[model samples]
Target: MFTEARLYSPVTRTGDGDVTVHLSEEHPGVRDPEYRARRNAIAALALEYVPGAALPRIDYTEDEQRVWRTVSVELARKHRRYACTDILDAAARLALPTARIPQLDEVSAALAPLTGFRYVPAAGLVPLREFFGSFAERTFHSTQYIRHHSAPLYTPEPDAVHEIVGHATQLACPRFAAVYETAGAAVARLRTDAALKFLADVFWFSMEFGVVRERGEIRCYGAGLLSSYGEIEEFRGAELRPLDVRAMGTATYDITHYQPVLYCAESVTHLEDVVGEFFATIDDETPARMRARPVSPRPAAAARPRGSA
Candidate 1:
């Protein structure tokens, strides 16, 4: 089981002149040479892309297009049923093509007017600072490769479908966009690794795996849930606790399986007010102060973060 303390596994090269993209055991095409080459090549393209310049283009193969369409259509159904109203409204605005994979440049162009955010290329692990810090400039460094075609519905890592469909959908939503913008601004002020990691954990819970109650139903707004074909259906079954910043910052989680715990906002406005406000004020001192608290309250429904005895 993996936690979100650091970047996902890095890409490595072997003496045999082959590349290995570190992935979870569930990754379907791990042993496929073709997929490995394709992934490594696209990652190279991301490396060459210059910040603030036009993003590099990716020419998807027929098989890759098939993979995109399959996951797109399947996740669409799950999104409508499981997604929050604002996220669905943003999806309507995006009207992303289901028949083909849109290049990151195109995704950037579409998102420009909506949130002033743009997609940039990312080969592998973008140092945590540059990755999240770029948000202050409204840039998202996204991975270009599609997941292995063998399992269109699942990916061991964040692939194209997860980046564009999951995040682009929410970013186009003004309410959610504001949340990220504030987060970006927060990172600009946070210099310590302790503080930045604290912010990322909160985001992982609220923006990545957060749920909210609306009209008497608990539905999802997080990108991790929106784009996940299988996990989206299972989050409602995870332990649902009310939003609590202290619990979230210290919480540990396994990234490789269905998340066993999640936080819920009382409503969309509550999520925006609570999480958004916290993001707006994070600083180097915030982490130390939170940890120094004499008696931090426990999350009601979920167990302690990963590694807690």
Candidate 2:
């Protein structure tokens, strides 16, 4: 199935005239011709309805600007404390470029070379299957907007704070990149909805909100925990158990409340290995029902009455 891209137009006001920034349905500044062509094809599918339609203008008031500045400062402070220095040093050693609230163009240029992944600035939420499909094809969806200080601690949906500060930094690592790509591939191969639901549980538990032990200490790794001010403390200090997928079964998390527990991994490599193995094992198993089906009563000769001595 083809994915549709949504276009957005963000506006800024000045003394002279309103300045509008358009995020084209078509991704721009992608160096690879083949990658650009693939995005263009997707865009063509998206624009069947949009057809170059201009988006509604977003006006930023003085108060909004102040809120944004304050939020940026707070985010920067958190970034300094939580960001993995080893990852940053590795990125720098590899001469990987960095950005503060990078545009899709910048992310696309950086990621496309490492993997075929390119950034798409989503207008709203995409279906889980579609999101997984994009990852299978090495495309990462991101939102263009940033969260404001008014809700510094929480946002209903992922803004640039979670996308850039939390997710993109880890994408720079090669091992983590392979893990994500493999998980996406597994998601794409599953035919049944039950299997998808099970895998999503696995993803939610590990990839989005997992932690790992390093040097005899627990540390924040998952993007969800890293981005959230409250979760970071809770995940590290609270009760955590080893993630045993087979025993625990599939489960969903409460997004609004601080997580009471988190899964711990021996190392990042071990986490990747375990996920890969779990998918392989589950792919072969038939989904078991939680409840038994009713059966009709048997004949007197074939069945014994209850409590017969």
Candidate 3:
């Protein structure tokens, strides 16, 4: 029930060569014609992209830049409190622009020296294999569109903010970038849909939404939480379970709301041992082999974090 597809809206091309981003009824931009036009225009840039060409650039509007500025400033403040040292240090080194929306090329330029990772445009949902597989080549498929200007802190799907702010920062970290590349290699090794889904499931929990303990506090490294204005503040309150690859891969979660539960690594070292090792050795048979074993009982909640339960 929890396919990664649910996290994105569909983009389609018309016979007339126009692009349309089909927004759900609940999307904040669904009723705004101007916002819909913006989405379609940006999606067009991605659709028209050619491999090895320079990444598309969006001359973001004044309002769009304001949203980026507001969220970036706010998220930066929260990052100091909730982000892990790995992310914090890497972010300092990357130093993404806080006053405006940086283009994909700019992000790639900054990351080129640090992690050798570059950004490619995505119209919307990238096929799981292609999306994950790109990482093996040190390339990341990214969306260039900012979220609806009305909701500076909320988006129903991944936007440039989430891609650049959330993932680009992670990609800047050498350790985190290595894991991403390894996960891409794991994707290349898998031959079955189930195995691919299993890999994606694990990715969702670890790379996208995982947490780690640092300085006696539960800090976030996952892009999903790191880019989010609200989720970052609320993740520590979720039911904290120990990091277990099988558990994370098999677990089902809702994407429409704040996550009610999250897995925690005892430390960054613990994260590398369990999560990093899992990605490095995973194969097509790994999913069934691990799933066939009896599912372990969920570990009890981790020790209450320093600030709140």
Candidate 4:
């Protein structure tokens, strides 16, 4: 359930417009079979909008808005403890004038000055290659949908909570944004599917669920970890290691539970340096045949489940 302070009313748009939906914990049930089916359908549609593909505009009802807000607030509350003050400060600075769902055109206009990226309305899940490809081109593919308030913690394939609030605000920061671009290009240049998979795993661990040491304290920077209320305590007390690219092949990580271990970078520049080195190493190799092979759509088989129980 969501707190009243976090529950927001849905805003509507007409004539092929997009809106953010905030869900209430009690209303707009999350267990409805129809809702799940619709979401799955959307996920399928999202997959179709892979690299070089454009997504179609979509509409949302008031119910959807409530769901989005519920999840967004839950994520914000959960990660508040581990959040980087600097990143949060930047987010606060870039906060929209209103709490209403942002129109795609409006989002694009706001981000135009900072980066060439534009918000593309999507409904389905995107493949990893396409996902990284979007970042490589500075085009951030975002979903126009929101989760139900009743299921604030539920994972909706690609919801607005994860894309907009979790990642977009960070994208507005120059250093962070550059990391995304550089990482994307490296993924593209890697000549083997296995290498790409290894890199993706590194990204999954660090970017999506990573933590960092700041001023003698560990803080959350990975959006996936920062957006979940359940993860804050786990990550803070979890074992952390310095990121080692050479050891990535033998490295294993927890993906299901709140991460119990994390890899740290002394600084953003160090993180960037490591990625640059990995990219250079891969580029020096004889282009592997696997490079042209498509990445798997399913989650990595070796990915450690949550909790490791």
Candidate 5:
């Protein structure tokens, strides 16, 4: 299936069970033997985390640790200036170390006590159904690999930086975790593909790219904005629309670039209320209803991918 996920994530499995996630040709690691070996080793470990087993472990190289530390420090600075209070607070509580790559078990341990969410390793491209549906059980499927070393601050794919620092930080919050749980429950009730796709769109806009108005300033809570060192600074430039679930479900935008359109909640509490209500009440008919109505004018896009995260 040529879905939006494939646009950002490397395909994980082959029919015989062997799997690999490759670096893009432009990635400097594509030509570095040691970096290639490291990626392959991590991919193998991720594949071991299928069921009834502990999450796989990785002994991160000094170079990978450097990448983690670099992003940690740089992203933290951006987060303070641009992140929403709730997200900042949760990250403080998690206290994810900045010196080394934290293991999946470590992240799961930290997140569970706070939000009942735990990290599970992923080879790559977790099925969208499994990805979103796991939220009901408070599970997060996460990739363990670091991005290619040459571009420590950049990757066109979701690395551990995006999974842990980006999504995990937000998932640790009770309110944000509740919304994800509700979303999973809603997915459980949806019987049609249209409904699921619509739900994904809503989630992408809100959970992955959402913002909030706080103290007369636009603040970011979405993981996509919180993790990217470059884009986090530029999000304020995007056109901000008030939280509108219908428009969110049908809104159009490019996934390959920084999202030029974002939905804003009045506040963090407002975020939970509006998104939570839609999740609680949405059914099979919800997508059809939203699709039947015209979304306010925007450039054409049919699918909304959670780019690199």
Candidate 6:
């Protein structure tokens, strides 16, 4: 249910190779004809793509570039205060441009030497299996369109900012890349939908919105948090539990709002160890087995009622 807002988007391709990106009524770009046309044009590039061919370069307009610049400068500030050392180091190495949105090819080029990861285009929502499974090949599916310029700091879906500024920076680190590959390999082995969903939920908790403690402060490593100017400012105040696979897989969250409950790792090493082992060992029966047992009781502090201040 949480992914309805965070992951899913309406994209339909016609038999004649035309692609239409259906924006939600509430979407910032929904009422703008120019933005809608721009989305359709960008989506067409992905539909016409040939594997191993050069990625289509988007000529982002001045307004789009301004949105990218605004979000980049603001997020950089939040990242310095809230992001974990692992991601901070990787971002520094990637050195993404702040004045303009980087093309997928540029991102892929920057990543080739660091971790052998590269980017591929996605018109819209990539199927769960194909999206995660591509990690094994060290390829990431990225959307090329920027969010509507009207809301530079907000987006209801994963745009280029989320794909590149959020994920590409993390992929610059080998440890994160290895974990992603391990998860992709695990997805390939999972048979039942329940098992696949279980792994996805665990990933949602870890790579998408997970946090860890370092030097006595809770730091965010999750891309969802790192890319959000508002969410990054508030995540440290959420209910934080120690890392637990069962808890993570079974937890309920709403992506339309700030997450109320979050899991924490003792450190980056702890996060990698627990998440990596889970991906490495999880199978079709893993979810059933984990769900059969009860999650441990929540700590008193974590059980306190959560809400915006």
RMSD of each: 3.9, 14.7, 3.5, 9.4, 3.0, 2.8
Clashing pairs in 1: 252-305, 252-306
Backbone clash pairs for candidate 3 read none
For 219-258, candidate 2 gives per-residue lDDT tens digits of 6666776566555545655557676564223443445455
Error of 5 at 29 (Å): 2.4
State every prediction's TM-score relative to the real structure.
Answer: 0.91, 0.65, 0.95, 0.71, 0.92, 0.94
**Better-scoring candidate (TM-score), 1 or 5:** 5
- Number of the top candidate by TM-score? 3
**Which residues of candidate 4, in runs, are more than 4 Å off?**
1-31, 40-57, 74-80, 96-98, 156-158, 248-250, 276-281, 284-309
Our tally of clashes for model 2 stands at 0
Top lDDT model: 3
Residue 54 miss distance in model 3 (angstroms): 1.7
- What is each predicted model's overall lDDT from 0 to 1? 0.81, 0.53, 0.88, 0.57, 0.83, 0.86
Q: Which structure is stronger by TM-score: 3 or 5?
A: 3
Model 2 clashing residue pairs (backbone): none
Better of 1 and 2 by lDDT: 1
Tens-digit lDDT track for model 5 on 216-301?
99999988788888888788878778898998887666666788788999998898888889988899999788778776676643
lDDT of 4 at 85: 65
> How many steric clashes between backbone atoms does each model show?
2, 0, 0, 19, 0, 0
Cα-lDDT of candidate 2: 0.53
